[model samples]
Every structure is written in C-alpha cells, then in structure tokens.
Target: MDKIVSFCKRRGFVYQSSEIYGGIRSSYDYGPLGVELKKNIKDEWWRRLVHMRDDVVGVDSAIIQHPRVWEASGHTATFNDMLVESRTSGRRYRADHLIEEATEIDAEGLSAEEMTKVIREDERIKDPVDGGRDFTEARPFNLMFETYTGPVKGPENLAFLRPETAQGIFTNFKNVLDTSRVKVPFGIAQQGKSFRNEITPGNFIFRTREFEQMEMEFFVEPGTDEEWHETWIQERWDWYTGLGMDPENLRVYEHPPEKLSHYSKRTVDIEYDFPFAGWSELEGVANRTDYDLSRHAEFSGQKLEYIDQGTGNRFVPYVIEPAAGADRVALAFIVDAYREEELEGESDDSRVVLKLHPRIAPVKAAVFPLTKKEPVSTKARELYNDLRGDYSIFYDETGAIGRRYRRQDEIGTPFCVTVDFDTLEDDQVTIRDRDTMQQERVPISEVRERLQRLISTGSAAAER
Candidate 1:
C-alpha cells in the first residue's frame, strides 16, 4: 500500500489535496495519469452496465437533493456510525473500528452499547494515540454533510450532500419510467459524487469523506427479486475478475441477517484482498425489498409502483442494488497491477512495473525518439500527433531510451514506440511491449493499427 501510494504521487497519478497548504486529511486529487485511469474504469463500467444492456439506462443526478428525499429513504434517521473519542488525545474514532483493530473481530453491526461494553471489558484496546484507555461513551454520528440552500440558514432550508447515489436513482425512478421504454426488471444506473462525514476516514481512497459511486438500482417484481439479486452478484464478481483481478484475492461475504441494513432484505459484499486491510468490500449487492419505493410513495404521495399491462397487476418493484465506490476500485486496480521485478542479468537492478489491463492503462502507448536528432524527433512527434486523436499517447525525448521505457513502465503504459534513424529509410519504427520488453519493427502507418489490436485484446486475453 505504501509503495503504491508513493508510486501514484511520484508518477503523477494522484496527489494529496491541498498539499501546498499541508494537505487535507483523506482528500486526494487525481493527477494526469490518475484521471485517465479512473475515467477508463468508469467508462468500462458504463459500457457494460448501460451501453451494452437493453435493460439498463443511465442518469446523472445532482449532488444535493431535497432533505426530505433522505428522510424518505431512511438515511436521515438511520445512516450513522458509532463514534467514540479518546480522552487522552481528544481524537474521535469509529467504535466498531476500534474494536475491530483491537480484536480482529467484525464489529460493524454491533450497537453502540454493545461496542462500549466490548471496549470497556477489553484491556488490550488502548487509544491509538497516547495509549490511554480513557474514552467517551459510544454515540451515533450522522454521516451526511448538511448545508443550507438558497442563501437561507434555517432548518426548513437545510439540505445534504447526498451520502450515496442510490437515492438519486430512487427519486428519479418515476421520471425514468415515464421517459424511457424501460419497465420492471430494468435498471437505473448512476455514477456521481457522494459525500459522508466519516468519523475515521482512512485507508487511502478506500474510505473517504468524498467519493464517486457507480450504483445501479434494478427494479423487478417481488417474486423475481431473489433471482435478480443472485444474478447481479455473479455479474459484479465477473466484472472484477474479467478485468484481470485475481480470483484468489477476491471473495463474496454474506451479510448476516442481524447486520442487514434497514432497506436490505439480504446483502452480499464483493470483497477484494486489499494489502492494507485484508479482505474488504469492493462493492455491495443488496436486495432492497420495495422499501425505497414504498417509503417514497408514502412520504411524497406519489405512485411509485409498476403496473403490469398484461395481468393488470400493480405492485411496488423490489430493488436489487449493486453499489460500488469508484475510487476504491481504482485503488484496487493499482494495487493488483503493482510489481517489482529483478532484472534478468543484473541482480542489483530491478524495475517497478504496473501490469494494468491495456484497456484501462493511463497511457495506451508512448512515442519516443532514439535521440534529439532532427529526423528521429520529427518522425516520433508526427507519430505521436497522429495517434493522439485515437488514444492517450505520450511523447518523451529527454533521456536514454531505456530510461524512457522505464518511466512508461512505472505508469503502466502498455507499449512504447521508438523512432530511430532506421525509420528514415525503412519507414518502420520499433514497438516495445511493457511486460515482455520484446521489440518488433512495424511500418509507421501500421503502428496505430497494431496498438488498436493490442489494446482491444488487452495486455493478456481476459475473459469478458
């Protein structure tokens, strides 16, 4: 995790937000390469979830919504984390997290009283700072970030930065149904920013106050909800593994009945083996049993039900929600792709490479000139410009060719195209594969086509 974090900052993938002002805690700004990689991941998700499916449609909702929307969705009253403060350091921490860190126990669903009892009884649970055992009683801290609307600061004008994108989709369900051809068993997909006032937001981008979510609410008839839930679980699992995630490092964790959310009849998490936290949720697929629509219908006095045209049956559609943190998944990809390999001939030398899937790699290919000479530099620049329209191409002519290749490797550029003196006569350039370090000569015109094929095929053939 440390290595990946350092690599991200060093290679212009990510940087701490407000670094010039001593940085904000847990806040990050995606740099040049980071933005590209993150966008590729979101694009791939949208491609599969919305563009490829007849049953799914997309929506972009505002970050702020009517306060009553959250109230209707149960987030206002129920969305909270148990917080306990250390008397010694005056620092606040999530009580469940404190218990988890102390005993390696899954304490998430435990009540504040129960967590307090555990903390009091366990002598090993000391303050993370100063090592003092004195602490405050556990209490619920609402995760929503509250703000005012329209220059008003009164209670009636209060609004919240949405804690999740699922509510946005829920509130727009009727609108989507009326506007689109979608019916029951179809999904409303959304990808957007969500905010939560996390008590202890850490673990890099895994848990942050602000994050982006790729969420889908698949509404189906009551009787069919279970089967759809299972289907989405499998679909989400395949997505991670299909994108080159190791199956061994991934697992499905079922939420016990007692731990289920208020809206969830059943919930299962797709957890990735994070280097820092072991197996943790990369995404969640939940069976929301008509709770959302029913609540919204009752609260807003709107009809949020599906009418079966053939049978004349009217019922609230059960929702199958698959919610994922975009930032978390991006971090997982970076962690999974990181590699440090010893050079074959030089035992003392090694190369750090990111074996990212070509389709999601920040730079698809880099164009390099063998030297600063006229013809080579000009040819490389021309090739770089030609491919820029089709892909994210990098042009580097600063250092030795080997050093240049190493720079590209560090940032997960899949291929490096080198224009040398031979290109002046042969009209061919050398293409080097990041992983194999193997080179092949191809006509300048064929370079684009070759990259297209490689990117389409991916670094290695991954089953989709």
Candidate 2:
C-alpha cells in the first residue's frame, strides 16, 4: 500500500486535498493523469452499459434531493452508523467497525444495543489514535447533512444532500416511464455524486464523504426478479474481466438474508483485491421487489405501475439494481494495472513500467526528439499535434532519448515515437515499444494508423 501511494504521488495521479494548508482529512483531488484515467473508466462503463446495449437508457439526476424523498425511502430514519468517542483522547470511531476489526468479522447487521453490549464486554475497543484509553459506549449517529432551504430557520423546509444516487432514480421512475414510453423489463441508469457525513472515511479514496456512483435500476416482471439479478451479476463480472483485470483478484459473494439490504430479497457483491484491504466490494447487484416504487407510490399518492397488454395485468415492476462506486472502480483499475519490472540491464539502465492497457492509459503515446535542436523538435512537435487531435500524446525534448523513454514507461504510454536525423533522409522514424523495448523504423506518415491498429487489436501489425 505504501508503494502504491508513493507511486501515485510521484507520478502525479492523485494528491491530498488542501495540501498547502496542512491537508484535509480523507479527501482527495485527482491530478492530470488521474482525471484522464478516471474519465476513461467512466466512459467505458457508459459505453458498455448504455450505448452498446439497446435495453438500457441513462439519465443524469440532481445531487440534492427533497427531504421527503429520504423519508419515503427510509434513509432519514435508517441511514446511520454506530459511533464511539474516546474518553481520554476525544477521538471518534465507527463502533461497529472497531468491533469488526478486533474480531476480523463484519458487524454491519448489528443493532445499536447489540453494538453497545459488545463494546462494553470487549476490552479491545481502545483508541486506535492514542492507543491507551478505552472508547465510550456505542450510540447511533445519523450520517446526513441537514440544512435549511429558505432564509428562516425552521424544521418545515429542511433539505439533505442525497446519500446515494439510487433514490433519485426511483423518485424519477414515473417521469422517465411517462416521457420515454419505456415498459417493463427496461432500465434507467444514472451517474451522480452523493454525500455522507461519515465518522471514518479512510482507506484513501476507497471510502469518502463525497463520492460518485454509477447506478442502474432494471425494472422487470415480479416473478423474473431473481433471474435478472443473476444476469446482471454475470454482466458486471464480465465487464470488469473484459477490461483486463486479473481473474484471480475478483470474486462474487452471495448475500444471505441477514446480510441483505432491508428492501432486497437477494444481493451479490462483486469484490476486488486492494493492497491496504484484502478484499472489498466494487459493486453490488440486488433484487429489490417493488420496495422503492411502492414506497414512492404510497408517499406521493401516485401510481407507479406498468400495465401488461397481453395478460391485462397492472402492477408495480420489480427492480434489479446494479450499483457501483465510481471512485472504487477507478482505484481497482489502478491497483490491478500497476506493474514493476526489472529490465535486462542492457547498459546498467534501470526502468519501471505501469503496464496499463492502452484503452485506459493516461497518455496513449509520447513523441520524442533525439535532440533539442530545431528540425528534430519541430518534426516531433508536428507529429504531436497530429496525434493529439485523436489521442492524448506527450511531447518531451528536454531530457535524453532514453530518459524520455523511461518517463513514458513510468506513465504507461505504450509506444514512443522518436524523430532523428534519419528522418531528414527518409521520412521514417524509430518507434520504441514500452513493454518489449523493441524498436522498429516506420514511415512517419503511418504513425497514426499504426497506433490506431495496435490500440484496437492490443498488438502491432507486422513492421508496416
């Protein structure tokens, strides 16, 4: 984990928020490379789930939702974490998490009373920060940010920043159904930010107060809910593995009734291996049988139902939801794609590589000039401009050619195009492969086509 964090900071991937003023706790700002990588991951997911499929349609929902929406969805009442503050240090901790950490088990389903009992009985609830004082008894802490709507301070118009994107999809279900003419067995996908006033938002960006989610609610017939749930689980698994994640680092765990959500009949979590934590959920697919729709229907006194033309039946549609945290997905990609290799020591030259798939690499390829002189840099700059319109290309001429190659390798640019004096005699330049360290001379005009082909097939064509 330390190695990964160091590499991230050194390579300009991410940084702590407000670093200049002593830093903010558990918040992060993505750097240039980090932003590109994250955008690519999100675009790929949107392409696979929305553009490539005919059944799935996407919607963008607001981040701040009506407070009554939370009341209808039960989040205002049930969305809480058990908390314990230290007696001596005054530091706060998630009580269930501390107990779970001590026992190496999950304490998610425990009640406040149950958590308080365990904290009192167990001596291991010491301050992780100070290390000598016992923590206070467990109590429920609401994790919602409450605010007033108007200039007056009153309880009538209080609002909350949405805790999850799933509720927005549910509240707007009838609106989408009416506008789009979508029937049963259709899906509404959304990507938006959610907030939580969490006591412990650690593990880097793995858990944060403000995060984004890519969630989809697949509405289907009631009896076919289980089948759809399994189908989406498989679909999500394939989506990750298809993008070059190691098969061994991913798994699907089925949830028992006790572990399932209050509204879900069945649940499955897609877990990924992280360096700091052994395994954790990357996404979840759940079977929520008419819970959200009925809640909204009862609250708003509106009918959120689908009418069947064949059977003359009218009832609410069952929902199979696949919810994935965007930041978690990006972190998983970084962890799985990271690589360090020892070169053959051709001339005592050392090198390290990121081994990111070309599709997700921050820089597709970098253009290099053999020297900082006029024509070489000019030619390289021209090539950079050409490819920059189609892909993200880096142009560097300040360092040695080998040093520039190492820089590109560290950032996982798959190829490096070098322009030298030979390009004056023949319009051909030497292309260096980052992974293999193999160089081949090719026509300068063919660089764009060659890279496009290589990125498409994950391999270069024969020396063309």
Candidate 3:
C-alpha cells in the first residue's frame, strides 16, 4: 500500500484534494497520469459494453430527483447504516464498523438493537483512538444528501442527490424506449457521478463521498430474466478479464438470501484483492427483476411498459444490472500491477515497475534518444510528435540512456524507442522491450506499423 501511494504521488497519478487548505478527507483529485489511465478504463468499458453490443444503448440523467422517488425505492426508510457516538470522547462512529474493527467480526445485516448490544455488552472491544473503554448505544443514520430546488429552502421544493446511477436509468427508461425504438431484451448503459454521505469514507478512493459509476440496466422479458442474468454475469466477468485484470485476484461472491437487496432476487459481487482492504467489491452484477421500474412507475404515475411487437404483449421488463465503481477499478489496476524487483548482483539497485497491460497503460510507449546532442534530440522530438497524435508517447532527453529506460519501465511503457547515431546512416531506430530489455533494430518506416500491431494485439509476435 505504501509503495502504491508513494508511486502514485511521485508519478503524478493522484493527489489529495485541496491540499493547500489542509486537504479534504476521503476526497481525491486525479493527476495527469491518473486522468489518462481513468479515461482509458472508462473508454474501454464503453467500447466493450455499449459500442460493441447491438442491444445496449446509453443515456445521461440528471443528478437530482424528486423526494418521492426515494420513498418508493424504500431508501427513505431502509437505506441506512448503524452508527454510535462515543460517550467518553464525544466522537461518532459507524456502529457496525466500530464493532467489526474492535472485535474483528462482521456485523453486516445486524439490526440497530443487535449492533448496540454488541457494542455495549461485549467486553473485548476497545477504541483505537483514545483507548476508550465502552461504546454508546447504536442508532440508524440515513445517508441521503438533502437539497432544495427553489430559493425558499422548504420541504415543498425538497429533493435529494442520487446515491446511485441506476435510478436515473429507471426514470428515463420510457424516454429511451420511445426515442430509440428499442424493445425488451435491451439495455441502457450509463457512466456518471453519484454521491453518498458516508460515515467512514476512508481507504483512499475505495469509498469516497463523491465518485463515478459505470452501470447498465439490461431490460429483458419476464420469464427470460434468470437466463439473461446468468449470461450477463459471465459476460461482465469476461469483460474484466479482457481488460487484463489478473484472474487470480478476481472472484465472484454470490449474495446470500439475507444479504441480498430488498429488490434483488439474485446478486453477485466481483471482488478484488486490494493491498490494504483484502477482498472488496469492485462491481456488483445483480438480477434486480422489475423492482426499479415498478417503484418509479408507481410513484410517478407513469406507464413504463414495453409492448412486444410480435405477440402484442404489454408488461414491464425485468432488469439485469451491472454496477461498477470507476475509482475502485482503477485503484485495483494499480495495485494489481505494482511490482518491485531486486536487480541482479546489486543490493541498492532494485527496480520498481508497473506491469500494466498496454490496453490501459497511461503511456503506451516512450521515445528516448541515446544522446541529447543536436540531431538526436531533434529527431527524437519529431518522432515523439508524430506518435503523440496516435498514442501517449513519452520523450526524455535529460537523463542517461539506461536511466531513461528505467524511468519508462517504472510507468509500464510497453516499448521504448531509442534514437542512436546509427539512425543517421541507416534510417532506423533501436526499440527496447520493457519486459525483456531486448533491443531490435527496425526501419523507421516499419516502426509505426509494428507499434500499432503490438498495441492492438499485445503480442511480441508483431516483431517477428
């Protein structure tokens, strides 16, 4: 974890928000490298889910909605976490989290009374902050952020910021259907920001107050839901693997009957092994049935039915939802790819490298000149400019040739192109592979094609 944090900061991957003014807790700002990496991840998701598929369309929905929406969704009454206030130190904590941290046990589905009893009656618990002896009674804390529409600041204009992106898709289902002329067995994919007032929003960007979600609601015919649900589960599973996430570090956990959401008939979470948090959810693929559309239709008094063209059947469509936190997935990529290897015959020359797959690496390849002299630097910059339009290219002329290779290697640049004096006579450049450190001399005319093939197929066979 420390290695990742230090590498991210040193390489300008991510930074603390408002650091000059003592920084905001649990809030993060993406640096240059981080922004590019995040954009690649998001673009890959859109390409695979929405662009590549004929059945999935996309929509952008508003961030705020009417208060009644929450009521119909059961969030007003049930979407809450148990919390407790420390009597001695006057600090508040999520009751379940405190219990779990102190006793090293999970209290996920426990009721408020159960959490309170566990905190107060359990004698093995102790506070890490002040060495406090006991805990206060537990209470429920609602996480919605309330705001007003008009200037009056009254309940009449009261609305809430969305806690998840799926609700927006539900509210806009009819709009999409009417415009796109899509039938049942289709989907609406979305990528947007959502907010939650979390009590303990630590662990970097894992559980932030404001974050982005990439989600899809695959609406299907009623009786076909179970099959489509399983199909989408496997499809999404394959999508992650295609993006180069290690299969060994990823697993699916089926939600138990008691652990499922109120509307979810079935649920499975894709968990990733992070350095600090072990196995935590990176995405949730659930069979949400028709719960979202039904609730919204009942509350808003709108007909959200899809009529079958062939059978003339009119009914609501069941939804198979795949929800992923963008930040969590990005952080997982960094954690999974980070590596520090000891160099041969040297104690202090150990190397740090990120073995990121080329598809999502921030810089696809770096171009370096063996010498910083007049013609070498000029020629290298020209090549850098040419490749910059097609790919993210790194140009370094200030360091030794070997040092430049190490710098590019640390950030997982797949290949490094070194311009040497031989290029002046032969019209060719030497390419060094990051993983193997093998150098090959290739003509300048073929370099672009070789890079394109390698970046596309991720194969050293391109060099053949």
- Identify the leading candidate in terms of TM-score: 1
Candidate 1's C-alpha runs over 4 A off are: 104-106, 346-348, 460-464
| TM-scores for candidates 1 onward, in order | 0.96, 0.94, 0.95
Question: For residues 1-464, what per-residue lDDT tens digits would candidate 3 score against the true structure?
Answer: 66677788899898989999999998999998998889988988999899998999999888897788789888888889887877677777888778887787789999889988787777777665787866777888888878899889887998889888888898889899889968779999999999888988988878999999999999998999999988988888898887667999999989999889999999999899777998899899999988989988998899989998899999899999999999999999988888788777643477778877777889998888888897987888888888888878888888778777778878878789888888888989988776666788988888888888777765464345
What are the lDDT figures for the candidates, one per model?
0.91, 0.85, 0.85
Off by over 4 Å in 3: 345-349, 459-464
Candidate number that wins on lDDT, 2 or 3: 3
Q: Encode model 1's per-residue lDDT on 31-134: one tens digit a residue.
A: 99999999999998999999989999999999999888998988989989999999989999999988988897789888889999999889989998889999
Is candidate 1 or 3 superior in TM-score? Answer: 1
Clashes of each: 0, 0, 0
Residue pairs in steric clash, candidate 2? Answer: none
- Per lDDT, what order, best first? 1, 3, 2
Candidate with maximal lDDT: 1
